[model samples]
Target chain A: MPNEAVQYLLTSQRDDGGWGPYPTLPSRTESTALAALALRLAADVEVGARASATSGARWLTETQLDSGAWALGDGVPGPNWSTTLATLALTHFEGEDGAAAAGGAWVLGARGQGPNLWSRALGLFLRPSDTVELDPDLKGWPWVQGTASWVEPTSYALLSLKRLRLVGPAADTRAHIDEAERMLLDRQCDDGGWNYGNSRVFGDVLTSYPDTTSLALLALADRRGEPAVTAALEALPGLAADNDSTLAMGLVAVALATLGGDPEPIRARLRNQLSTWDGGDIRGLAWAAIGLLDGSDPLGLLDG
Target chain B: MVSRRRFLQAGAGAVAATSMACRGRPDPWTPEAAKKPANSPVAILGAPDYDETRLVEVVRQGLGICGISARNLRVVLKPNLVEFDPQGVINTHPTLVAAAIEAFRLEGAREVVVAEGSGHRRDSQYLLTASGLQEQLDDMGAHYVDLNHDRVRRTVLKSSFTDLGELYLPETVLDADLFVSMPKLKTHHWAGATLSMKNLFGIVPGAVYGWPKNPLHWAGIDGSIIDINAALSGRRFNIIDGIVGMEGNGPIQGVAKQVGVLVFGEDPVAVDATGARLMSIDPWKLRYLEATDAFLGNVGEDRIEARGESLSSFRANFDVVTAFEETKVEPSTGGAGGPARIDK
Candidate 1:
């Protein structure tokens, strides 16, 4: 099944050496990064994985913005959210250390400064809700600069930084990573899983999503024994148990495996799910492959 | 009360006159022609209920008035699938999406694809299932495209509202012969209201823009709306799902405010302006509408020819959040510097 998934990903790669969310879409950095990471992790289990991963790494290095970050692609402005994934993919391969370091530095510097005093003060009176319990002062990585921090992007940043070992070695870097972790913890809903950003808004408790919850937990993988982590893990089943989302299922499998929990069920489910996938969804195939690869840290590849 | 026959006759005359005015131009429906009172006829039908059969008829009639003949055209219906809440009407009703698909098919559409890139959540499958849109799409045998993950083309903007000069629009959006803005009329906390123009935010894929498409928000919501509206100038139409709307704080996180009416028009600005009026919001007060008034078509009530139901007959004051209500600008006086902000 992993071999088939890898073949799907390899075949799905465009002539540009990048993959898109779907086979029909143009090659995007996000899908390409995910595909590269999956192919790298599955090299031992499948043939041609190494070759595909090399081409993907080349695409990442070529597309890196002068600012040391990757844009969303096709001139969509930014050194934005896709940067972390691109950085991680580049760092996994040989001879790309220079590009990887620059990308890593950009990710570390991308932490958004929490909204200004005026914005915060105005928020107090704007649609005041009893259901939401988030602190306005906690800062994390935003999808873009000068916007409220969201869980998924923040988690990706954390995962990438941790993989690069940039979480320490400098006072400011450590502080930034610490604050981001705090922000993630602070935004957890009463229901135990995380939403996109706001836990509650205007007295309505926002529903927790499986993909977000899985990503948040994956970022906090080292702290699986913490009370919050335990609570989130317990709450995850309710959110994700019956979920047919390939993205969510893949993330959950990786997160559970990292936390020393049984990922077999999720791995099996994802494997079965991918069998029916008509080879168009590159993201799903990439995630499914990464999730099913046993005892492999796709994010931690080449870190040590 | 304008009769349907009279409205169609007037529309035909305007089309002919515009065709003569721009003889060599590729598109006869120029901005000047679209703004003419005879051209921009908005259909405001009294749905009074969410009955699928009745709503389908309303969509058929409204699309007809707007001159949306679907023969051989690949139509894309962009519904407000921003978030899903079974208990709350956060998304466009699945019944409405189904009705539109059926109506288009009956009108001889080559293909009618239902697409949305939900801003609030990346899990589109969950949203599709939770909102019951999946079931409807399945029953109708319609294809659903997650616009956020679709192939993209870098499009240069002719008019930029924010610092961004270019945007990566989904290939699906660019491939369509006709793009229908099927938005749920609601009060937006940041932008005053999420109608036709605001709903276009979903067309920007999350694969590029991030969930909630934060880049656009950072670029300034009003400016991005104006920019996207300008980019999608021609081949754009608006059919607002006003039958059940969210008010007070919306796009997500608002209580349902049932307006029980379906609003439709060829001119997105005029349709949205009329929608704002139905919600008791002054269209001139919205920053985006005010800024793009010249080229985007008229938001003024005087420029739009109302058909079917009257505005006053279905008027409901949707509760605007304090933040948006505070940002309201005074009506434009045809002066320099655009509409001025009245000191509250």
Candidate 2:
């Protein structure tokens, strides 16, 4: 990891011992978790770096709700989308086992059972066109409960579960992971990328976005032999080449490296991109650090 | 059983008798009748096309009708910069935003800032650059604040439609003297249609609500719209871009339909209603508009006065997807409130 990126992540930490998406924004769980994981992955035992990660992990553990989910903030809703990232960050610390386990259980229980019968009925009647095929019944994760499942939240949850080995030798855990995998595959766009969630809405095919595609690919790295995964891999290079988004570029690089594809070109491109970055964006800096780790399993608790 | 001439004669006689009886007495319903006058006026100007120069004049004329005076007002033009699509009319046109800034500046407004918290993407810089709004703002020397990362203050909702009793809105939204909502007139798969009122969804900070502002979605799209608009109350005005609007399934991912007009009004509900009329959808059918009629603005045609171009001249049948067609509410019978629909 570049020293400058690491330093940026450390300095951008809010006085509350959390990090926000950008320097000026209030600290958020997702940004704080990603930043903490990046620092832990750097594996520099220096006092300043270790303290930063510990403080961030502590914040995540403390802010966790009684239900083990972390709502977005004090007044937002349930920490539905943020729990996975927070759980992954907590696994980096030694005393956070209980919080991590509770969060993991909460995340496991949060899978959306798709829309109910009434909603499905409404959908069938209200859908603009039937040209695009999708099964709303496929159980997957939603960013929030009672809403339709989307790709990014599902992918991040899967990545956390897999990294923590929370999907243990139990049958239900295995089944849950298998269902989530199916859901991710089902949501993949025909053009080999993923959108927010649905492959199509109405008659129009929603365009696949680079950030969502990269996150989905990163979560499904072990299943690259699957046809959908292979197609996604084929589709990623062009997106990475064309995308100027720092976060997208970094995530794509990490995903590509994890999939045993060449990372050198992406790494070089990212380095060039980071050269122009001022590091005020803590989220981008965190992703850039993780990408620069070059195949290191930052979120994997057992890797070390 | 009566002849037509005899029926007309009887009706006239009854009216004359009632008028004679009420002549020296004040009618009990007079106060209520006086209170509920005609609906607010919404300006629908014909621009023919997206001529930047012509758009400036059209916007100026529309604002004039809407009673917007720029002198010494801190104006914030909140445009919908949801996402960028080079071939699609997804975001508000940069030319229109630029024109609004120029119009406000020419009116001697103290300040005009272009603001939006993009619900779909977190990277405001990228969205601004890709949407062409950044260059427009830069060229016009107008400030552009990403509401997603802007400093926010939590405001208690005393009469919220949603379960959420409070919202953390950006300081810019709360501080602006004149908050102008500039939404691209488009059809939405979920909300039926997204006009000025639906566009206010972008005002909620993404940092608090999460990208795509899922919390608002969970709170119920229609209800959330009511809640946010109610919070902003009297400070809001609307300017809708109907020059090249989206149809079918939209908000994103839809075909562009050019309607060649700009709709503006101080009442967001009325302006959106006018835009909906031009799109050939009944405003009374939209639940958010229906629910917010009394508090926000009335959607009733009898209440609204039209300015500039006539509605019939620019009306086009916007193709609503079958899914959102379920959102269409039947016209309501006159009651205490305006139109009402059971929540879906």
By lDDT, the best candidate is 1
- All candidates: DockQ: 0.34, 0.21
Please give the RMSD to the true structure for each candidate, in Å.
Answer: 8.5, 9.0
lDDT of 1 by residue, A1-304 (tens): 4456787888888899888777876777888999998898887788999988988888888999899999876556667688888877766777877887788888877776565432343353233463246766677888776666889889988777776773223224667778888999988988888988877776667778777887888888767799998888888767878787677788787777776667787878777877776654577677777778878455562234
- Per-residue lDDT for B1-344 in model 2, tens only? 01111211222133433444446443211122122235788888887776778888888898898787879999999998888889649989999999999888888899999989988866665667677787888799887777876777787664344557788898899999999999998998777799998998899986666567776766566667766877763366789999899988788887899888889888877888777777777776666766555455777777788888877777776778775564433223211133433321
lDDT of 1 by residue, B1-344 (tens): 01111211222133443444346433212343333234478989989877899988899999887777989999999999877677647888899989999998889999999999888766776678768898899899999999887767788776544557878888888989889999998988778899898999999877766768877766567767877877763476789998889888787888899889999988888888888878877776676776556556676666678888877777786787776675333323211132333421
**Candidate 1 residue spans exceeding 4 A from truth:** A1-4, A65-67, A74-80, A116-137, A145-148, A166-172, A296-298, A301-304, B1-39, B48-50, B154-161, B290-295, B324-344
lDDT of 2 by residue, A28-52 (tens): 7878888888887776643477888
State each candidate's clash count: 3, 10
